[model samples]
Target: MNLFMSFLLLFLLYTDKLAGLNFNTDVTVTWGQSHVAKSRNGEEMEFKMDQYSGASAQTNADFLFGRFDMRVKLNSPDSTGTITTFYLHSPNRDLWWDEADFEFIGGSSTADYKIHTNLITDGIGNREQQFRFPFDPASNYHTYSFFWTPQQIIWYVDGIPIRVYRKLSDSRILYPDKQPMKVYTSLWNSTAWTGEVNWKNAPFSAHYRNFYVNACVAWRDGSNVSSNCKIVPPFWFTYKLLPLERDMIIRMREQYMTYDYCNDKEKVTDVTSIECANNP
Candidate 1:
């Protein structure tokens, strides 16, 4: 095929395979309804926050295991301090709360996007992994996704695997496989960790497109199927891609990664995790 034909073919194939988008209409607007608006002709959820207020939204129901995705565009111009978040967790508070988080720490320019990922098992010490996206997220929309399963967890950006945390290979660590979790999204002031008010120009906004769930919902109720939903896990889980996925992760980390807990000098100890064995 010619170059043009090849490009077109790829585009068509990608779109044809595009996952279905679903908004958690049953979702709850945790706060600041006045600051939230539906735009993109209802295809996108625009969340805004100023010096006076912020906005948040969370799924009303819980899902046991699934691939959750959200296309997002961070606020441009000056996006410091304002934090935009997407996560999954159960209602259990304190030591029982199980959470997996994708947090945008904001940057001064559209070209500099700092993303922080974390997994909180049983409300324990923070296990944070951070990266900086080279592309200008504010210029357009990019899909961020979380794939949760009985064996492992994979984090993806634009369909490319960025990080993979396996189900605990070590007896010392805990995994979040037992409880179902609700999907959560929020936009609020994070100047404390981001920086002072002066460093994080306020009055920023967050844009979230339709969320896509790629698994049967019945898993939440302790069954293999759902009465109202029918679906299967995506192909990424079934194949072995250490060669390809590892290269993608290495390229991104070499150029864009900012911090990783696995590489922390103090944290890397007499014992090491095979997950950090320079493999994905």
Candidate 2:
């Protein structure tokens, strides 16, 4: 009986330790300002911005599929528009690049959340969608989170699941399924979309406080241990979604890329650069 009880005690202790490790509070802040380190954090990096320029911060963990969480509080006076972002980038140009992001934009007591995806070959294939989230993000600190896996992408507002994208794919395989992306956050002015809000009334200063970030990779196959980046998790293999294979996803990405860079918003039914227009 004593032996059995001892094993039980050990099991309980291990469980507690594992639970603690799963939700670590390690924060790495990267400021948009040039002075900040690329993957380190300190008191000076706490979120604060003014009219002169915008301030932003990002974390270093880069993974293809994982959970990302952060708590943010916006300053009331600067509520004209605030943008909190989570994004990933391509370090090298040789490999086709893939990126996904969650954006909290507009400087109001209320905020709008957006999700964007980009697949890069010659240029970029892009898609974006938006939704509303509760929490007067300017008043109090609230947790904003995302869960990305091979099959779906989910978002949370203050711990409540607000959005889920299970069908945002246009292909069944090769959708940049295996790629690494770092975590990023920033507070910026919403000049692009906040025309409805009264910017003049907003104080020049906006703040993001109690900023926190946590990341974990559910699985990995061939990965190296790097300080600022992580290898793509193995689970992404399940997605089997290749943007190039799907006609619609590829078309959508091409349209957006043309519009974003070439300013070609209209679909050119039969025009120039046929290869550039339809070849992914």
Candidate 3:
């Protein structure tokens, strides 16, 4: 492994001693309790989806900024029309909510699987980017993670950065810095965006393990301020991409990216007002 990845692995190994939250104490099943299962040690969790219902779970604590990571093995093969999601979301569902998503849309075959990502600020979400995994995501567990700081939101697949969204000065492009969000994961049925479902492969399931978070926890009073974590400003709060990492991001985007909403002329009104306008 490279130096960066080695360091990340080391960090993950010591996560429990470095303030990692407990799964049973910090997380709770929010939907389809019957469909959510835990291991004998409570270190791994599973979410299942059937023709009847799907399962979801969320963290009890809210966070303002931090690095969130999850190792997931998507539903087994023939998982058409199923969607497995890991995301951070504000409590509100109206015009002023904030969210960041990592949604895996199941396909007919391993080659057809799509990793769809999106961000929403002030409830206006047109930022959608999709990529294809080189390996079969259902075959084994792969780490899907993201870093949310004051300046940028970066998506990563197996510790490799794939996409980034920066906070721009333009008022037209709002960022999610103002709201505290809770981490959530779910497995559900959806065919509107994904293709038709094959109920023949019923009872689709997703496995999750190694939930790690090193972030500024926020209070529960619905306030916009974060709690007084001793690390006032963690290294990640001001983290920037290194030259090598930037190069990797470019190469990955060119090779794996299938779609980017910023490139859609019909959907974006004034492209100049968005961050991608300058980056592209």
State the C-alpha lDDT per candidate.
0.72, 0.44, 0.83
User: TM-score for every candidate vs. truth?
Assistant: 0.81, 0.53, 0.90
Preferred candidate (TM-score higher): 1 or 3: 3
- In model 2, state the lDDT of residue 167: 32
lDDT of 2: 0.44
- Residues 1-280, candidate 3: write the lDDT tens digits: 7867755754565354345455677889999999988886768999888888999999998888888989999987888889999999997778899999999999888788899999988988888889999789999999888888889888889888888888787887788988889999999988776878898898899999988878888875544465646355765567766555677778988999999887787677774346676442
TM-score computed on alpha carbons, candidate 3: 0.90
Give the Å shift of residue 52 in candidate 2: 2.6
TM-score of 1: 0.81
C-alpha root-mean-square deviation, candidate 2: 11.3
lDDT of 1 by residue, 164-275 (tens): 7776567666688766788888998877788644434556788998677754354344443242233555443352334456667778878778888778877664334554
Query: Number of clashing pairs, model 1?
Result: 0
Report the lDDT of model 2 for residue 279. Answer: 29
Give the clashing residue pairs of candidate 3, or none.
none
- In every candidate, how many clashes are there? 0, 17, 0
Best by TM-score: 3
Clashing pairs in 1: none
lDDT of 1 at 27: 66
Give Cα distance to truth, residue 132, candidate 2, Å: 2.7
